[model samples]
Target: MFSIFSLIFGLLSVVIGILATIFWIWMLIDCLKNEPSVGNDKIIWALVIVFLSYLGAILYYLVRRPERIKQTGQ
Candidate 1:
């Protein structure tokens, strides 16, 4: 009993969710691998990503990843 628009919206939602999950996982791995473990950065970022989910990932991608890559070239 789903209309065409409703069906399309549902599919779009699923696709977005899947993409968000992938982004989240990718950020987590990138943080763990590329984030320097000088102090507690890696642990802190991992915790933030784990607790905040996609939002944390987005934050890290926009904020720390650029700086880390620039500083460490990793």
Candidate 2:
């Protein structure tokens, strides 16, 4: 009985950890590839995301990226 419970929780933890890792990697890549037209804040936030981990990624996308920077007129 205990073995079955452990297996289920362990599997769930692994899956969640993997998903978080993937999202972290994706955010790092997004930061690097963001255009100069997007401005310096983008790079700053990207560095923040890479250095700070998951919270940085969430903050970058949720608050900074869409709301802070304007699209280039050109």
Worst ten in a row by lDDT for model 2? 65-74
Report the number of the highest-TM-score candidate. 1
Candidate 2 deviant stretches above 4 angstroms: 35-39, 68-74
lDDT of every model, 2 decimals: 0.94, 0.75
| Candidate 1: residue 28 Cα off by (Å) | 0.2
- The residue ranges of model 1 lying beyond 4 angstroms of the native Cα positions read none
Enumerate clash totals for all models, in the order shown: 0, 0
C-alpha displacement of 12 in model 1, angstroms? 0.2
Best by lDDT: 1
lDDT of 2 by residue, 1-74 (tens): 99999999999999999999898888777666663534576568777998889999887777755654465421
